[model samples]
Target chain A: MIVADKKPIEEIIESVKEFKKILILGCNECVTVCEAGGKKEVGILASALRMFFLNQGKDVKIDEQTLERQCDHEYLEEIRDVVDQYEAILSLACGVGVQFTAEKYHSTPILPGVNTCFLGATEQRGLWTERCQACGSCILAFTGGICPVSRCAKRLLNGPCGGSSKGKCEISKDVDCAWQLIIDRLKALGKLDEYEKVQPIKNWSTDRAGGPRRVVREDVAL
Target chain B: MLAEMEPPKGVDISVMMENASRVKGEIDAFVVPEMSNAVMRMSALGGALLLQKNGMDTVMQVCCRDRNRLALQADLLAAGASGVKHIMVVTGEDPGFGDHHQAKAVYDLTLLELLDAIEKMENGHDMSGIDLCGSPQFLVGSTVNAGLSAQALESELSEMNQKIKSGVDFFITPPLFDIASIKPFLSCVDLSKTPIIPTVLLLKSLGMARYMARNVKHVHIPDELVRRIQNAPDKARECVNIAAETVHAIKEHGFSGVCISTIGWEDKVPDILKNIS
Candidate 1:
């Protein structure tokens, strides 16, 4: 899921200060799961903004609404009639959602209320760890389900670099060395021979190095 | 024949200069490490240039951990312009091991790509395919880890082949105390075609030897050598003697050369080389 974190209340306030009427938008997707942007978070932000404005003796109107999923056109169109009523919309969604909402609404300013972190999983309630870098090319089959591109500090294909010691990265004792995990997994699975094969230089063209990417699916096109 | 000299952490190069001058005529070329162990220090290029200015040959080590492709290319061109000839590439230790733990690692190019970029610049074009003002020629070298296990050794050999294809002039292995330990690596890689220089690290103490043997993967410090250091009356002198003996053994085996690494004890390097000659 796309993990995100809520922007500091002060920064959000600074961004939406000039507007007499503002709407705090939230998404019911990944951000909601990560507890960054959701219906409950929308209410909390709206209350905080209202109290902040009340203390300043301002007559600012703050409204709150959460879409099923901001990335989808149908959910975003649900706010079409009321979007123009507010001076600005604070999107508590991932960067993609904010951009999509901006493209659909075009006129009103779409401000991001949460910082989109990465494509990761919730390890526990509060702990989220990154899982993939969307490098476009995947080599998990050879690496025993570990993703070096996202996990390794150096992003080394042929790893664990000399820095790996005692199953931890040289960077930190807290972080588990990704290559160590790969080697151990391979060893356990009796696939240590896979590790003997030297991985060639990765073709990063499929990655962000190739520049802004787009997928054209003729079969799925409407 | 090579000695590893780490650049000083601060501005003062008095100790570094003095150490290099001590063994000036003793060794072939001083291999100046670039902030080795991810510790911040004077840039390797700067250290190499200073040594070169003093009429000494130096192999400047470049790591892909810190700089992007542009910065790397710029530094390479700078090294060329400054007349520092030999270049050794390494995938440096992670920044977490260094003082600056919060710094971001910019590995824009893999080791092979960086080598390819160096080759490209030598061919009179930058990584972007733009023509260079002038090409910088260098004796390119890189490090290889000859693992303890057969599987790991095979993997290293395969990568060594790739690095050779990338035009690496020489290869350096991790510190080796026992020649028998690297027998697997020795049998697999032919020394004549591509020169392999094994590092002879001067163990600071029995604790360091034990720590490296247990903690540092890929490095194999023989039990007998560790016990030898343990039983010595003077540990430091014993460490130096062990280094000298390893260098002599490596020479006897008819390998290309040996790189003597003193860690921070560059002062003891003179003593290590004294017995070698």
Candidate 2:
């Protein structure tokens, strides 16, 4: 999921101090699961900001709307009719949602209420740790479902470099070595030998290096 | 600069330390706990937790809708052990308003009954009437929201006063978005001895203010601050700075202290606290 943290309220207040008619766009994807940007989050933020604005003696108008998925164009197109009417948009989505809102609403300014962190899954309440780099590929199969791209400081395909010791990353002792995780997983799957078998370097062209990527499945084509 | 924040100047520190030194003096912040966790979501829970963890000396909020009396009692015990210091009682919002639409709700105890039970527990009896090996000493608090309906508000306050008589140490309020929101209710404050900590909702975004204006019944968002948020170059930060500024205003208005309630935008609380101190 697209992990994010709500932009500090003070920072959010600073971003939209100029606009009266505002729309806070919430996303239902990663931000929602991570408890950063969601329908409820948008509602709460709207209420709190309204109270703050009222206290400051400023007249503020806010419209709260949550999208099924802000990163998708179809979800963003839903608010097309009214997007022009608002002075600005407060996107409670990740960076992708903010950009999507910005792209869709060229005439209106779209602001971010959340700081887009990397892709992650929720470990539990109030804890979200990064998991994938989304480098336009999935190498989880070879690494036992753990993405070395995000977990390892160096995205080594077959790792446990000399720097990794005692299953701890050399950089931060507090963090477990991603390579060690890979080894544990591979061991569990009886593929510990696979790590020893060095794989060839990946093709950078298929990743973000080549620019925007699109998926077209002929079976599902429009 | 990682924001060099020391305990303000000597005079300020002295006054602040003096205030801090009164920890045992029986004064409580009495901020409203978000009773409707599933209805309001964990952001509300997260917000309250952050405040208590960050040193607001906050109260733990527990409502009856999400859990049965067992869950409520367990969480109550958890909050007590977590150093939350206080607990607020509420018969939470209905589950129909929540995402778990089809989920069943268990309301084993009403707000007043919950208070009585807590009081009994505080006096060292378990809710089951059995002697517990250990029990926590908690300052039990309750909420006081001026209902959108006038008569309901009056009856609620009277009922709340009754709760206070049954060992509610203090009372916290629903968001006081505007002065008018609190004024009419303050004129009717019937409780004596127990301090009332009026809550000020910190609106951190212009869009948020307008959302409350339309959706939240009883809460009114003023036009002026919205206009300022509309005019500021950075609206989100402006929304929050204005909120921090509001905390100052609320403190200045002679309320006990501001109950920092912005959950999603809690980073602003430190800023608000910085300015308030």
Candidate 3:
């Protein structure tokens, strides 16, 4: 899952003020799963703006569409011909989808209506919280797959911080201590000895600081 | 009763952000925001917001079918923060007819919780303990279908009274075909003293009348209404005509005003309002 919060209606309407024809676009990928840039939210924003524009005596031709995935070129191509008809596009997808849509269409202006927060999971109905940092490192086998960089407040590398009390973080009492989780996992795996090894400083350059990392499998690609 | 909220000074229809700014003295706002899922499902919530913004002395709706508790509370708080005057509480429809069939529906806070939440909201706290920078005041309303008669009349009266205790300042009755369905309901209330607005339902299509009657229980659709609509060349168009007459009937019955419920034919609301005047 992912996390996203909707932008205010006034700001959204202001962005598409010039477009007499607008297509409220939604994404069915990560955005829809996270409840950020989904079809339902698209309707919400479109209706809000339509009312706002109509009240101001401005004419607006508002239509809504949700694609399988906006980030993918193939999915966006479905609307290639139709998009040319609209004056502007209001994308409810994440930063990735919005960028993709903008890249695909040269003539139309694409505006984002959601603030994409993070790659996360559905904690409950209508609630999405962060889970993955996409840091290009997987210590899941060693640290129980709970990335401390994303879950831990301080990103402590070793055992629990002194701030840990009752397995909860000092920053927020409701939050669980990530390092404490890592320690418990190490114990269960009989790798408590790894804790005594005195960990070296993290090499982020090898992870993602270098940027745009890719993976390849000869068999799969072939 | 909500008509009193506007300051008697002058007109102030410009929208204020979720801030301290408010529209001063404007009655009868035209709250008709565009409907969600124009491909299928339509809602009056948008209209409610638009009308409130334009200073129509609006009565907005808090539907049960849309958002869960979090979203509902946020929208309600936002509505109040935006200076919405009145709200008509309703149980919204499912999303099958719309684009979002898989989209979840939340009824976490029953009508009671919603009412309680709104009342709590008046004190500056949302259900989540987030305080509003400023207080929000709105006249709460509840929906009642006066057509049901299987239940005892006393039980029906008690239900209406219960919602009243739950913070509903006004009540909007659902649409009815013959006076029989509403007559029993009227006998239960002393409308001479009460301000509860009696709104009748308008059948927009023969398919719609049959659709509603088939799906909803105890909702009385007049036989003649069904027959007349069945005979019409353009049943969908005739629905608007029947709906308009229902509004006129509601007005003739000495009710303060009618809440035109144009479920499938959402566009017919403005026409009904026009005919009502």
Candidate 4:
């Protein structure tokens, strides 16, 4: 799922400083799953902001609302009635949701309350790590289920770089050498013979390097 | 000058002291490796500061894979404040190769970008065009690969040129088993502008040589070198002899000096140096 982190309270306060009335919007999708921009987080952020404004002696009125998902137009339309009650919106959704919400309410400014990090998975309840770079083509199968595109620091397709020492990356102990993981997984699976296969230069046109991408499904197109 | 010390895992002052004292009279400067093995230890910058406090000239190894532009600048400023003037800038190994399997890497700047940033700071400004309170002066260095396939050779040579253009004062090659292998690479370089420091690793055993040959990238371990170590009756003496010979060969090729990595055999450094002088 797409993972995000909440922006610091101070930065959030600064972003909405000019607004007297504000709406703290939340998404019940990926943000909720990752515990970043969920309804609970929305309340926590709203309370923090309210307290901050109270301490500052500012007459700021903040409202809270969470949608099932902010990416869809149908869920966004629910805010059409009460949308005009705020000067700005603090969207606790991914970048996609914030932009979609902005498009939905043309007049009101939608401020991103979270920093959209990457396409990742939650290893534990609180630890989320990147899993994919959304490169158009996938090579997880060849790489023994490890995505070098997302994991390898240099993203070298052939193998681990010279810097791999004691199975750790040169960067930090917190990071696992993706190629090491790939080699280990491949070794465990008895597919070590495939290690010699050199991956050719990737077709990056399918990746973001080409440009902003679009997908079309003619069969489902209305 | 060969000061080789790996970055410590925690703030172990005793180990730092041992490391500092061991190379006291042997090397002119000690190199504090960046977060090697993917574990967060005392940072190279922090380690350099500690060594400098102990009265040793330290070369802080800075990698581009970790910090962004702002953090890099701030750290460089801090290094200058701490009186560390020598730095070896590297396009560090990826974080994915480290212990932290889930850490986010910030490769906001490339090696060229980093060297350029330092150069700009030396001229009295930050990357954002803000005037600096004080300028940091550094005798900057960079790492280069020794043995290379025809493909990597060209690209790496081009990169070395770009680094020199960005104001790198010196270049250090990876731990080389055979100095002759780098002759092709050296021929391509304009040595007058950037002096090359060839590094030699003291091979402890055949297993060590083979392991390095297979796992360590860019290191060239010729078949004969491995065979000699494997078949040698006195492996320890042979290791020192080979290292000493490699150092001699590098100097014979008209290079200034060589960087020796004992690889935990710090005691053997004096032996290797004995044969060299």
DockQ score of each predicted structure, in the order shown: 0.02, 0.01, 0.01, 0.03
Candidate 3 lDDT, B1-277, residue by residue in tens: 1221111112342322111123223124332322233223234444445455654556666766666788777777677766677776766554444554444454567787788788878888888778867767887777676766647656767877888888888776655666666677787777766566654566656777888777766577767788888998987667767766766676677765555544334344455544543
Tens-digit lDDT string for candidate 2 (B57-110): 555566766676777666666666767676667777655565444444566788
Q: Residues A62-163, candidate 1, lDDT per residue (tens digit)?
A: 999999999999999999999889999999999999999999998999999999999999999999999899988799999999999999999988877899
Q: Model 1, which residues run further than 4 Å from truth? A: A1-222
Candidate maximizing lDDT: 1
Give a tens-digit lDDT track for model 4, residues B1-277.
Answer: 6657775677666766675586678678888888865567779988888888988898899887678888899999999988999999987765556775445566789899899999999999999889999899999999888577588899988888899899898888888777666777877776665688888888888888889888978788898888888889999899999998888887787765578877556667778877874
Judged by whole-model lDDT over C-alpha atoms, candidate 2 comes out at 0.70
Write down the TM-score of every candidate: 0.59, 0.45, 0.47, 0.56
- lDDT order of candidates, best first? 1, 4, 2, 3
Q: Could you tell me the TM-score of chain B in model 4?
A: 0.91
The better-scoring model by DockQ among 3 and 4 is: 4
**Candidate 2, CAPRI quality class derived from DockQ:** incorrect
Single out the weakest 10-residue window by summed lDDT for candidate 2 chain B: B1-10
List runs of model 4 lying over 4 Å from the truth.
A1-222, B214-217
Please give the clash total of every predicted structure, in order: 1, 53, 16, 20
Global lDDT of each model? 0.90, 0.70, 0.68, 0.85
Cα deviation at A222, candidate 1, in Å, is 44
TM-score head-to-head 2 vs 3, winner: 3
